[model samples]
Target: MATVIISALLFVFVLFACRSAWKRQRNGCCGNDIQRLKKVKIKGDKCRDYPYRSLLHIDGMTCQNCARKIENGLCSIEGVCATVRLDQKEALVRMKRPLPESLLCGAVAKAGYTVLKVDFLPQSGHRSL
Candidate 1:
């Protein structure tokens, strides 16, 4: 009888864990950050010249979904567009004008990720780490 009770408790614990995971997934890790990104409008490009670009090294991404979340979050910034590579754990961001490194890092942080490094990629020269 004790064995049966222990088994039942184990099952309940497993179920609870599953439900918690599902909730986190549904919320997309950083729920408020995702929502804020969704509401942002893409700023129009006034200059037809070259766009400023940056490369970001990120951490704490477990899957492609995490990459997508970061991409979406960064893209929401004004005058910014991003491409995230899950395998590389990096993001290439194009911006209409130069933006502060802190802003870039903050966006990733809001998405429940860490920005390990930010590199400026010049259009004519090699990347600056």
Candidate 2:
């Protein structure tokens, strides 16, 4: 009877601990808060043209921090700038020229994530004649 009581207490304690941890994660302690997204600034010359754009789908992102890490990693590549959307699990990358998908995948991998796939979004008003 005493053993059963002890086990029940332990189970309750563990359940509460897990609930607390989950609440913290949902509250954005593990990553950037969604409320702070508007405050984020990427300093670059917007007037400078980027002719190529690609969308990267990534996995293993638990928070905005993961998205930021992947963005920073991709931006480190020459002539590339990236904006990562945590809600969408996607990164919109703009480049001065086209680059191989492996390069982008490697960047995500280096940031401790996996690239599930990449898709090129059609550019504005450029249909095949």
Q: Which candidate should be chosen as best, given TM-score against the real structure?
A: 1
Q: Where does the lowest 10-residue lDDT sum fall in candidate 1?
A: 31-40
Cα deviation at 68, candidate 2, in Å, is: 0.6
Alpha-carbon runs more than 4 Å astray in model 2: 1-44, 123-129
lDDT of 1 by residue, 1-129 (tens): 999999999999999999878877776554323434443344665322326888899999866568877987998887887878889999988777799999999999998899999999876323322
TM-score of model number 1: 0.66
Tell me the lDDT of model 2 at 85. Answer: 89
- lDDT, residue 55, candidate 1: 89
For model 2, residues 1-129, the per-residue Cα lDDT tens digits are 999999999999999999888877776644456655442344575512566788898988878767777888888888887888889899888776789999999999998999998998655332221
Task: Show model 1 residue runs off by greater than 4 Å.
Answer: 1-8, 18-50, 124-129
Clash pairs detected, candidate 1: none
